[model samples]
Target: MALVTGGSVAGPGAVEAARWWMRMMRDPLATYGALGRRYGDTVRVPFGVGRALYVLSRPEHAEHVLVANQDNYVKAFTYRPLRAVIGEGLLTSEGDTWRRHRRVVGPVFAQRHVVGFAPQIVETAVAAVERWPDGVMLDAAGELRRLTLDVVGRALFGSELAGEAGRTGRSLETLQRGAVIGTFLPGATAKRGLYQRVPGLGGAIGQLDGLVQRVIRGSSGGELLNLLREGGEFSDAELRDEVLTLLLAGHETTAASLAWTFVLLSRYPAARERLEGEVDEVLGGRDPRADDVDRLPWTRAVLSEAMRIYPPAWTIERDAVDGDDIAGVRVPAGSTIAVPPYLLHRNTDIWPNPEGFQPERFMGEQQRHRYAYLPFGGGRRICVGAGFAMLEAILVLATVSRTHRLDLAPGVPVRGRAEITLRPAGPVPMRVSRR
Candidate 1:
């Protein structure tokens, strides 16, 4: 990394260049793609304030930076803004604080406890399916959001948050969009102020804050929220941080994951038929339970294949704390490295017919590197909720597959957008028919 200083003395173009870099960062895929086409994968957008962004999008680069010499990288400055919003949760905190938070929240997201939540997830999905009207076009993305939100609410806090999810969903959209942009700007009192002034962002934060407080005060289950409340390891502010982080992370990502899964299913009727048959044969119109996840391998594989193509948590970033060598490129200290699952999963070198829908690729044994799939990420800092989210998604998928078949409306284009997560920009219109 070149030391960038005294450029402002040259001209106003330096500052304008910085703003241009920021704009490009706001939507990285398009920016990165264009840059990669122009200057290959390692393109640095010089902000001219000793804070340039080096966007690298490849598997070897990702493996080297995110996992193999992981100690040299810290969460990028971009995470600082998300940290202000969520506090000392697993996603944002650094060093000991992150380690401690992970230790406390980690065990609950382990496979056993995560699988334990499958029953609640299935119940929620079954309940949603029962409400569907035959041949009625539905916003599948929104429906999946509601389902995931409900499951996260019930399974995490033992509360009925479905009623709040609609408002919460809209609010969350504003916050996510704002938070990413906000991360770069130097703000005063990021926790207590700033966002409070933005209309949708502020109002959404308030609503989310209130909910976090309520959950922290009293939760109905032995979920992570209850454990956090009972442990009293954090103060009110700290507790609010973790709760909000979990809510923001746990709900939307899972929702997008399922939404994409259903869309792919709609496009591939043969796959859908196979999936529906499996659900019928195993679950038999009953809701899925923890014990049945193993039997529903195709259901799990369908969701896996969807994520490989359209990962909700599409990108990951880390700022190098020290200079390191990744494959052959020399990364100097303070360089921001990107490991986007979107590109890695689509890498034609690793995945044959990468753009096609092929759940059969996941069948038999996976011979690829564990890091090769990487939807939930990898190593010690990998998503703590990976197991929990998978269990919930599979369970919900099974329950829905067993009870109803949703057909896509004729020729309705599937639109996608990349915010903090990659989501369908518009509704996924599909008609519901009871099984």
Candidate 2:
């Protein structure tokens, strides 16, 4: 745990900088989690020459960097590799371009309009669940990915993307691996061209490009597609980037959330029983509807608690545009700040019994720091599709739970892979049984 900065030990540096970097490159999620425990909420380590990275997990730190005094921060260089892939899409874009794109696309994800897509979400989930044969082993992660992709495809683009879900998932795996590697390489942002020259990187981008082309060419003329097309605001490339961003962001995180939910429910059977009971009571053996979302408090809480435990979008990073104080940590200009939800959500001070699965924590009225639970992030850049994601998760969980229950394969342990998104490292094999 020696702390090293600028290749020099500070106050008997508990952890060497090179050791931290090695650990980070190997498994960043565990490294960050351990740092939070050993060094409190904010840990600073010099990274790559004179630059430093501040690992800040405190809710106050998140609020300061992402919301209050937010203008002084921008998406950090860590996202540059992603920007190369997704281009200047809403998720990676900055400044006026981000504002313009947000304006053009924001309304469709508004709560009122998002609720309209619940039927499609539920329909897709039900159909996918129906395909699951009882008493058979299946990969819950893959199934949920297919379901969410289909939901986004039909609801947003009016296309059938379930067939492409597996391919898209593979491509994302490659791209996310490349992105994480790029974050540690020096001058990666400036040398994106060189970075792309690396083996397999080009193929990953090509796969994503091909997917976007298919989405554009096979458009079923959905509402969002129509807006992007008829609005006359985006060029062809811009439109492709936006579609790719939505296609990836819209499904991958939701799939991860659902996947983790199943894993947790399998481990905590009592919670699973309560969840099934709630779903049965709420829907009464019928398909879930948009209105039923409000009536299914436990379902929503289960999803909430799942995301709290394994947030799909686990980490949020931004570069300091100016020097300022955050949660009493001295942040210097040009430093990188990492507000990781994985650590924040598990902070013992913020969440009692942090490691335990208790969906009831989200039930009823409970007072807590706002940024402590940012599965979708916080501030203006909070997920544009947060409402859609939440509603989709609730309905899909309810729909699937109503008809079937998934139990993890005996003696199997589910470990998370912290790539661009937090997801099960390997197949989450589970036995499905008709309820």
TM-score of each: 0.91, 0.96
Q: How much is the lDDT of residue 328 in candidate 1?
A: 65
The TM-score measured for candidate 1 stands at 0.91
Candidate with maximal TM-score: 2
lDDT of 2 by residue, 1-435 (tens): 435442221311434766777888788899888777777777787766557888888899999999997998999988888887788899999999999999989999999899899878888887898899999999898899999999998999988999998888888888888888887666635354765677887777777788889889987788898899998999998999899999999999999999999899999999999989988887887898999888888888999999999999989999999888887777778989899999999988889899899999999998998888999888889999999999999988898889898999999989999978999997899999998
**Candidate 1, residue 136: CA error in Å?**
1.3
Give the number of colliding residue pairs in candidate 2: 8
Clashing pairs in 2: 1-14, 1-15, 2-13, 2-14, 2-15, 3-13, 3-14, 3-15
- Distance (Å) between predicted and true CA of 257, model 1? 0.4
Q: Which lDDT value does model 2 have at 257?
A: 95
lDDT per residue as tens, model 1, 103-144: 778888888668777667777887888788887899998888
Off by over 4 Å in 2: 1-15, 188-196
